[model samples]
Target: MTKGLDLHFPHQTGFLSLTAAAVSHQFVNEAKNWTEAQSHCRSHYTDLATLYNTDDVNALTQLGSPTGSAWIGLYDDLIDSWRWSITNSSFYGPGETEFRNWNVPQEPNNAFGQELCAHMQSDGTWNDLPCASAFINFVCYGGNDQYVLINQGRTWNDAQSYCRANYIDLPSIRNATENEKVQVVANGNNVWIGLYRTRTWSDGSDSSFRHWNSSQPDNLNGQQHCTAMSFSDAGQWTDEDCATTLPFFCYIADRPTVVTLRAVVDAADELTEAEIEETILKPLREELIRNGLPNSTSLRLRKVYQTNP
Candidate 1:
């Protein structure tokens, strides 16, 4: 019977324990505008801080414990950000979400930087307007492509609530055909659609989680487009002017690096390196996975200098 081989590894095996990527935060007390702060973060660390969950938010809050507010990574993009209220991607066909029929060059000029909501014109063209604009009618969509025009004037948010409570949501005009259908329902009066825009993270994370104070993100004075965390307010977030100078937080992550292990093993005299890999290394990897190693991790032998050492 062949006896078991006693193996020794010179370096850390990474396989014995899980290696997780750690994220840390750095607070720069120097005041800078949002853009400038973002530049500093990218230059020095990973990027402006992006809080994903309660844990992340709490960690950041505890890390800084700052005396005042600081810039984060979120910002409102006024262009190319229109989206439907019905966000289930499975409901949209190919290219459905990209549909738009703006009046072009003139419409959606974001007159006061507060034109975050979209509306349909009497001629079926689209325009951007402040969400709180009064006396605007809206259209609601039921399943099976059915649309209902509500003549009662309501703000964009109210209209959205009404539609959600009654129908599936505000109409998502996917193409000229759908746009014409909505226009026909309006019967020559302007109406609201589901299309609207919102803020996004600098790191391109699609997380929709937000921590805002009461009556926050008012887009105050139509100029507040950048986000900041107010440590004094229990780490709640608020939108501020992008040009406002404020201390900021940056996110940092450890770079992934290979942890190589020099393994010494005793095996049968006839065993080859490939045989050792198949008999010993393969089972070792399987055991590591069973213990807690991530499945995405890869293992391989770079080279074998000696058969038995």
Candidate 2:
């Protein structure tokens, strides 16, 4: 719906129609803190990426290394306020978006300082980390339905830049099946998963789907606020500091579009009833064919006339 971007698909549920769309994701090889990472992505392509289904996670995993973890677009801005990538209040309820799979008792202790970035472990759990600590890989999501996983070691900010330049921004994971798919690909690496408190999608969609490990989101130590995926227990989650930088993933979207087009012809300018078909109706048919529309398509047109208004 924007410039230089078009949505194209044979058929899609609840969407627009266009000639075609160009959606995709990329993997960056830099690092920075969570905030910096997001900024980097916004400056270049769209924003941090967000996930929707199993296909999204699985596709991203295929592009990533089966070792390290990547950054996604999830964080815990509030102590107990959890949200998704999209900021639509009406889409999800209080308990609807609260999906966490922490490793329990040991994670989210806020061990260091202000942790606010989310990541995924190779195993597919989650954790919260500091936004400006050391360095970790990261990822970004954009476009229609797309994702990417990078295999670089940098701070969150650095990773964001790399993604923006090469791909989109960090990605967001939406459902459990998607989480599991990502887990299988992680292969025991601590990658980033798109989840956090007060979540919002890069494309601004409200899809409620969470897969936290067991006894997670402890928000321990009051400092641990960010989120991440874990490897120890089937891709669960844990709260950590955001300052700890890491690698990440990025993506773009070009989802299939479906549009309903209609035309309302004004019959007020018609001729006499006796001359109707010959003067107005028959020519309309010829005009459609002249315009290059398929004859079959035109033949399917339903004949309807406004009797009142």
Per TM-score, the best of the predicted structures is 1
Clashes of each: 0, 125
lDDT of 2 at 173: 51
lDDT of 2 by residue, 125-164 (tens): 6777764534555555543545555666665556545654
C-alpha lDDT of candidate 2 relative to the true structure: 0.49
State candidate 1's TM-score.
0.60
**Position 288, candidate 2: lDDT:** 46
Task: Show model 2 residue runs off by greater than 4 Å.
Answer: 1-22, 79-198, 230-237, 254-309
- Residue 43 displacement in candidate 1 (angstroms): 5.9
lDDT of each: 0.76, 0.49
Write the residue-wise lDDT of candidate 1 on 170-258 in tens digits.
Answer: 88888889999999989999999998887888876555568988867777777888999998888889989999999999988776435
What lDDT score goes with residue 173 in model 1? 80
